[model samples]
Target: MIKLPFTLPSRPPVTRIRKCDAAQLRAPAGPRTQPMRGFEDHFVDIVDYIVRITDEIWMERAVGRIYDTYDASCTIYSSYGVVRSVEEVIAGTITTLNAFPDGEIHHLNVAWSGDEDEGFYTSHLGHSRSTHVGRSSLGPGTGRRSSIRFAADCVSRDNRIHTEWLIRDNGAQVRQLGFDLHEVARRAAEADTLEHFIVSPETRLEGQTPRKLLDLPTDTLDGWARHMFHNIWNLKRFDWLARYYCAAATVHAGGGRVAQGVRNIGALYLNIQAAMPDGVMRVEHVCHSEENDGVIVAVRWVYEGTTAPGGVLGECPAGKQVFMMGVSHMRFSGDRIVEEWMIFDELGVLVQGYRK
Candidate 1:
């Protein structure tokens, strides 16, 4: 099994993934040295490999492609549960496509690291628009159109993904589909046992050194991400929003909620903090790409704590601990972050908290 919460050695903060639009991203990679051997020849680079494979499997509706793109022993971890094996991945794909026949995901950006020799790790952000035309885990067809955000961090070798951490903005989808988020979670939790809700070792972060601004280097993307997450979220430094982000910065806080400006962004975060007063956030992974004028960084993080009653998540059972998995993509111009896409599964968190 792939180890969780492993730290990668820091590299000199130089350019990596490039900034490009959908059209540019899909354009021919052109002739270049293939970093990954044994990969498909059409994939000139790692980004192209990830984007194209995703398109082939999801958008193209080629469910069989999973057999080719994922290793037989691949495992997918998410807040709801773990999906093991390529066969399970294929089955899940079929089920999803069956529910939303017209579902299509638009890839926003990809931040990646590693090399062909060992393996490449990628954090891919996607925006999905779909209609609930058939029965699904959410229940029967509602014929409602839904838009949501999701992110996946994957490790690949020899043209096949071996492990993945996937998080979807499920609360957004449920609301768009006109379902009661809490009720849905409560029902699902009833069927599941308490053992499933226990926090895994991978999500624990107690007894660690405090991540102080002065102690952590901010020149590198890895350091910068750690600093921002620890100081702002863990330390409850709301004032740092202005100090770290641009005044005009925009945050896409999943479920179609977009907050513009530092004030609004801080408010979005405060809403969550209000629910879990003692929640602690820890960065599990970091990757970045340098563009012409700025940098784009992707951070995978986890938060855990008890929930207080009457907040964004509504009433919670006393002493109920919630574990949240999230992926955030930030675009930095100079020293300030100009844009961010914060994605997490609020629906899953509710289920975890409500599960008895």
Candidate 2:
């Protein structure tokens, strides 16, 4: 049995399990009679607390209560690439509230898994201000707002929040606030192309199979595979470097189509080269299938680039470079690519570079 640094809260007693004849065994009614709460319950409570705080800017109160109940310090890691202690987190919240009194946060969903004292929770949240003008500290402007579908992975200790990794829908937020995402993305793509155009000596095109890619250290391979699509898609002009993935396939979802397989992989490279002249791609993470077969692979990646005039997608003018990231799941057949499912931060890319 695992022991917590603090005493576990006693839940209301549940109905006792009734033993019946082997032939009459049935599920029990009401809550289970187990005296101890499981990891699931702990996770539920933490999620409930997060939901509550989002609805009402209860950072100060919630942080104190969390510290008291869990007997641990609370830290908040933000997607804006900022980390703060409970006190700083509360302060930031207060500032936001003061600047936009009507600002509110809406929690959409939370997906989590882990043990009672240690686990991870990912939640989607949105922030909005109904009135932007004449708000103290907030400059006069249209009452504009943005939504962010963010995810946070947190670790808990002694029932209190510990470490957290926050991820934000950067592209989505920008687009929602009336940004010209397409132009920005095009520009960024072009800029990235100009910056990292040369094929490196380390670049291997022919023998780069999924298994070979996976041959790197697990962490390195994982990162590369995750972002393979974005890198290949954004930097397609370097298709010669991706000869191994030329025959990759693709799968589609969410009303969008993703090209996969080796041939599809080639198409991805071709498309990027055709669409954006100067673009760069980066792989953030790659999650692999558990099957020992070297055929299937999946990944997530990010892209940044600048646009040149006469872009394949449209009349992308020079000047602005855009940055975007996305996730993809791919499957391979034999040594060739087979299928893929893809999603990206389209809105974020548009808004950051083109928002008026």
Candidate 3:
């Protein structure tokens, strides 16, 4: 037994876990510092860590900070696959920054879990609202702006990050940048003709396992995560939105996709089911936090189903099977949940579907 020091709900089918203690739950919510060479005794506030990641590492072009904040062997997992080593992360980081040189990422909120002993993890959901003025990923810049949403979960150890899982709204970016997804899809295939982008076997093994499986919800986050996957979503009871979410809640489903309030979010669900009536969802991993009054949860999940007759967007249903990997970040306020940020590989969905 892990001895979490908290009592879990015993409800039949789905049990809700109770909070550990008022005092512990209210423990220091702010950042703390730890001694580390070359870091000048930097505070371990994971939020601060996140700030440096965006401001210093990405925007400021302080590539050396990556080495300072990330362990030499840090591994990053994304739709593209697994990336290991600080050098790889540095190269990829430069590539992304090159794509959106003027792009600045803003954080809506963060769900943090774990301690330095086991490694700290931050489930950060936010907006990368910026313009495409540089020549990179999307090819030449259209000088157009894009407000892409992203969800990144990272684990830090030895005063540095060692693992990460990042999901972004690429489809929204391509479209907002005034480019056709099909064109990008075609280019992606051509670029990968040599299987150069495939995930390495070792990297695959590293990514398949999660580092710190904790979130901000103390105990109940797990129950909500489990219920959403096993019941509400799988059963397609869109009405359950009200039961699980706040009346004025916001749903940030990435790719510039958003729905406000329970009713509107429920409508999006309807549209989703309309596209993939037989969609099946599976929860690959769920991490929750226990330190704050509210819970921040990050869930790694997969959706698989064939397109319905109407299909998604304007495509006709050819019974083409589509699969997508999504990372969802939810913040709970009181009984019902408040805001949720979600992102998946929209480009991957189109590629997989159109290729068939």
Which lDDT tens digits does candidate 1 get at residues 258-349? 89998998888988777777787879999975545456789999887888876557676657777888999888765678889999888888
lDDT of 2 by residue, 1-356 (tens): 42211122223222211122312212222333322233223223444434443443432233345333232345553312234456655555555555445554443233233334334332222233333333321123445664444444455533445665444554444344454546545454444311121222123348664322323332243444433444345434344434334343454421123555545545554544443355556665333332222223333344556644453333444555554444444444443344443444443333334432
Q: After superposition, how far is residue 39 of candidate 2 from its true place, in Å?
A: 10
The candidates, ranked best first by TM-score, are 1, 3, 2
RMSD (Å) per prediction: 5.7, 12.8, 9.4
Error of 1 at 128 (Å): 0.9
lDDT scores in order: 0.79, 0.40, 0.63
Which wins on TM-score, candidate 1 or candidate 3?
A: 1
Between prediction 2 and prediction 3, which has the larger lDDT? Answer: 3
| Candidate 2: Cα lDDT at 3 | 23
**Cα miss at 23, model 2 (Å)?**
42
